[model samples]
Target: GAGVSQTPSNKVTEKGKYVELRCDPISGHTALYWYRQSLGQGPEFLIYFQGTGAADDSGLPNDRFFAVRPEGSVSTLKIQRTERGDSAVYLCASSSLGLAGGSQETQYFGPGTRLLVL
Candidate 1:
């Protein structure tokens, strides 16, 4: 069972550029979530998916941020028109479904994709 993993643990880019961060969740996980955390702040939920559909995406800051889980496994977060304010740690997590209606789950976080906008 692989835990959540993210690529480019550190990314440095200029303003107005585009970046795509990848996440690989644990096997057999059907619930996936993406969160962004800024300095001295808690992780803000970006999007959540059950299977291949986005169940929640209200946390996305703007149109510049988008994510997809096409196959219901690996997910990618794409950021367009990068801004210095976008610099933060992108975290991905997954969990199992309990007997309850929704998944009674605990998120297992990845090392995180750290993006730096210069």
Candidate 2:
């Protein structure tokens, strides 16, 4: 894809249900990030992956949230025991050399997946 792309633009699930959000980043990008945006707020960083390993996951709210990048191209964010408080827009972004920390790199963002827990 030309830019980052996420699957299932919208998802609605009952409380305690499990959900998986998929993100396919631009081809060849090495750095991927996941974020969450609530009403009237900016996106909050959740995790960042450099290749298949998670470089930073400190932003994850709790143990219930997890993300993985298996082949370094596609990533998935998994949520266990979803709650109404989890309702938000989940965003995915990718950059070619952002994690290198030499120079700032622009990250391409996807349309995001709106998750609503009832």
Candidate 3:
């Protein structure tokens, strides 16, 4: 089985540009999550999907950011008008059901997509 993987480990762009980060979740996983981590800070939840529906998207910062999981497997995070503040490591994780009750359901993280907005 393939573990979660993200494309473009590092991205550099100027302000006001747009970028799309991709994530490939583990096979047979039903839950996928996106998180952003800035320097010296913990990862912040962005959005999560269960099957083909967005189970929780409250963590999305603004309308400039959007994500989709049309097939309930691969997901993509798109950022519009990229700003310096948006420069951070975009992380993706997937789990069996995203439940914390059991250790077997813990989220496994990808290497991460690092974005640099100048």
Candidate 4:
């Protein structure tokens, strides 16, 4: 599809557990990003991918978070040793091109995956 979609709309996990969130971006998109949003805060960028390579990953909180895109299409965000504070909405977005001219390009966001860690 030419639109973004995420699997497992909701996830509940205990502390120290592991979780994987998936994101499927538009068919030909070359730029992909993952963000996390707290209860009332806006999404904070976690990672960015250009094609299948991670263009930027400095936004990830720590080593427990990771993301991958094998074919430059579908991406997955993996979290290890989940903590209660990790509970939030995981958002995925894709755009036709990278952030070349700032926020002028069209970026499509998927309905986020709600993760609750206890």
Stretches of model 4 off by over 4 angstroms after superposition: 98-103
- Please give, for residues 25-112, the per-residue lDDT of candidate 1 as tens digits: 8998889999999999999999999888999999999999999999999999999999999999999998866768375788788999
- TM-score, structure 1 vs. true: 0.96
Q: For model 2, how does the per-residue alpha-carbon lDDT over 1-118 read when each residue is reduced to its tens digit?
A: 4788999999999999999999999999888999999999999999999889999999999999999998988999999999999999999999888545722888889999999999
Best by the lDDT measure: 2
Worst-scoring 10-residue span by lDDT in model 3? 97-106
Ranked candidates, highest lDDT first: 2, 3, 4, 1
lDDT of 3 by residue, 1-118 (tens): 7799999899999999999999999998888999999999999999989888898999999999999999999999999999999999999999886455323688989999999999
C-alpha RMSD for every candidate:
1.0, 1.5, 2.1, 1.8
| Candidate 1 segments whose C-alpha is farther than 4 A from its true place | none
lDDT for position 78 in model 3: 96
lDDT of each: 0.92, 0.94, 0.93, 0.92
Q: Which one wins by TM-score: 1 or 4?
A: 1
The alpha-carbon deviation from the true structure for residue 104 of candidate 2, after best TM-score superposition, in angstroms, is 0.9
Clashing pairs in 3: none
- Residue 40 displacement in candidate 1 (angstroms): 1.1
Q: Which ten residues in a row have the lowest lDDT in candidate 4?
A: 97-106
